[model samples]
Target: MNTLKQGDAVPNFTAKDEQGNTISLSDYKGKKLVVFFYPKASTPGCTVEACNLRDNYEVLQDQGYELLGVSADSAKRQANFKNKYEFPFPLLADEDKTVINAFGVWGPKKFMGKEYEGIHRMTFLINEKGVVERVIEKVKTKDHAAQILA
Candidate 1:
């Protein structure tokens, strides 16, 4: 996977969120954003990461960051996960890999001694101008907010 790196410009794209609302990168112009990509919605690890963000949503916003979650799940599934967790952010339902591929997060993944192609759990911190300021590949699901804050 050709993962995006710090200092790179995040590709402009639009996709549907859990509410079937169209969201675009352009909408976040002039605002710092935290875009996190997870393997799936409602899964164990994914839940921790999302909940961590949700739990600290206010602090993150106070620090000038808007959060967004992305995954290759359908809108219905994403909605369920968000509703269940009461996440304070929007979760993009990237069923067609539009945002996933643009960020280069989909590639080979190994699990249970088997290898398969899947979405890599990653997060990108973008500055106000849309340039990636940080890329967190080794995400600490439970302490993700700390990682981002740090």
Candidate 2:
């Protein structure tokens, strides 16, 4: 996959969140945004990563960042995951891979010595102008917030 890198401009795409609410890239204009893409909802690794962010949500906002989570999960699944975790951020139910393809996170991946296509866990730090300032590919599931804020 031709993943988006630092200095790239994020596509102004619209998608539905776990609450089935329409969300768009333009909605976060004039504010720093954290767009994090995960493989699935409620998975072990994904859960840890998301919960880490949730636990540090206040610190993230204090630093002027709005968080958005994305996964190729159904709305119901996304809803359940968010509700269970009580995450303050919205989780995009990108079932069609629209946002995933736009961010170029869907590609080959390996797990347990097996290789296959999947959504790569990634986080993008975008500036107020919507241009990516940093791309964190080596995400630490338990210390993701530290990675982002670092």
Candidate 3:
């Protein structure tokens, strides 16, 4: 996949969140945003990454970062994951891959030698002007918050 790189302008995407409320990149205008894309909702690695952000939600906010999680799961599954973990951020149910394709994270992935097309786990740090300030492709799921902060 030709994933987005630093300094790229993020596409203004509108998608339904876990609660079915429409969210757009414009909603985060004038604020620094952390848009994390994971493969699935409530999966092992995805959980760790999301929980790490949840555990550091306050610190991230203190540093002026608003977090948004994205996955190609259905709205019902997204809702379960959010409620089960009590995540403080909205998890986009990108069932149509609108946001996922906009970010260019949907591509081939391999697990145990089985290759399949899936969403790549990555994070983008966007500046107030909707430009990507950083792209963390090799995410440290256990220490993701620190990775972003670093």
Candidate 4:
């Protein structure tokens, strides 16, 4: 998969949400969308990142942005994470890695001197026209939302 550039048109995808609801990228057409891809759900880093987005949800909403999170986690796990955090956004369960691979976020990752294949933390900002406006590749979990907003 090629790394999507700022002007690239986002690939259309349909993914299952925590509630088993099918969500299609087209559903959010004509709206600014923030699609964040993380490695897993409920982990420390993921939790902080999700919470940060939740905390800044109002601000982002005011700016006319819709947020969605994507991970290879199961629907059950995503539900637990969403419910636990009271997340006001959809978390896509990409268990088949279809969305992750489509966005080029699934790749090798190194941790503790070891490397393994996983989802790289990334966020794509898509404009109202469905063209990517930015690709946030270097994410700092603690204040990710602020960084994205910046």
Candidate 5:
């Protein structure tokens, strides 16, 4: 999966959000941003990671970071998951894998005894200038906020 690394320019993308609204990377220009990719919405690990971010949303904002969650799910499913969890941030319905592939987070994944291709759980911390400051590849789902903050 040729994942992006720190110091790389975050690829600009325009994708539909849970509400079917157009969200573009340029919208976050001049702001620190956190773009996270997950395999699916409403799954156990995804839930933990999302909720951790949601719960710590204010603190992250206080630190000048805006959060965005992305997954290869449809808009309807993404909306349902966001509503069900009351997430404060927008969830990108990246069904076409525009953002995912741009970030190079979609690739082979292992589950149980099977191997399949999917979105890897990854997060990119982008600076105000749209350059990646850090890349969190080993995400601790339950303690994701702490990991980001640390």
Candidate 6:
């Protein structure tokens, strides 16, 4: 798989949202997209990052950016998280890691002195033209929204 870089066209993907609604990248061709990949739903770090996005959602909208979160979680879990936090954005259930692998965010990670392979908390800022504008690799879970907004 090719690692995407700035100016590279984001790989097109279709995923089911928490509500089981199918969302395709092509559907948002003319809008800026902030697509973030997290490890799981309802986990500590993931929850904080998601809530941060919720708290800053208004500002993000004001800036004309659309947010979409992805994880190798089930639709049920995503729905529960969305309902619990009242997130204003959709979270895609990438149960098979299709989107995660396509974006090169699925790889080795170190946790508690152990090495394992999983989604590396990462965010991609895609431009209106579908090209990657920037990548946030060293994401801070608690201040994720601020990191992206910065």
lDDT of 4 by residue, 45-102 (tens): 9999999999999999998999999999999999999999999999999999888877
Poorest 10 consecutive residues by lDDT, candidate 4 = 1-10
Q: Write the per-residue lDDT of candidate 2 for residues 1-150, one digit (tens) a residue.
A: 989999999989899999889999999999999999999899999999999999999999999999999999999999999999999999999999999999999999999999999999999999999999999998999999999999
The superposed Cα distance between candidate 6 and the true structure at residue 65, in angstroms, equals 0.4
lDDT of 1 by residue, 49-136 (tens): 9999999999999999999999999999999999999998999999999999999999999999999999999999999999999999
TM-score of each: 0.99, 0.98, 0.99, 0.97, 0.98, 0.95
- What residue runs in model 4 are displaced by over 4 Å at the alpha carbon? none
Show the colliding residue pairs in model 1: none
Candidate order by decreasing lDDT: 1, 2, 3, 5, 4, 6
Residue 136 lDDT, candidate 4, scale 0-100:
94
lDDT of each candidate versus the true structure:
0.97, 0.97, 0.96, 0.92, 0.94, 0.90
Could you give candidate 5's per-residue lDDT for residues 1-150 as a string of tens digits? 888899999888999999999999999999999999998899999999999999999999999999999999999999999999999999999998999989999999899999999999999999999999999999999999888899
Which of the predicted structures, 1 or 5, would earn the higher lDDT when compared with the native? 1
- Candidate 3 lDDT by residue in tens digits, 32-75: 99999999898999999999999999999999999999999999
lDDT of 6 by residue, 19-136 (tens): 9999989988999999998999999999999999999999888888999999999999999999999999999999988788778888877999999888888899999999999999
Q: What's the distance in Å from true for residue 93, model 4?
A: 0.5
lDDT-better candidate, 4 vs 5:
5
User: Which portions of model 3 show Cα errors greater than 4 Å?
Assistant: none
Cα lDDT, model 1, residue 111: 100
Reference-based TM-score, model 2: 0.98
lDDT of 4 at 31: 97
Any residue pairs clashing in model 3, and if so which? none
Single out the weakest 10-residue window by summed lDDT for candidate 2. Answer: 2-11
Model 6, runs deviating above 4 Å: none
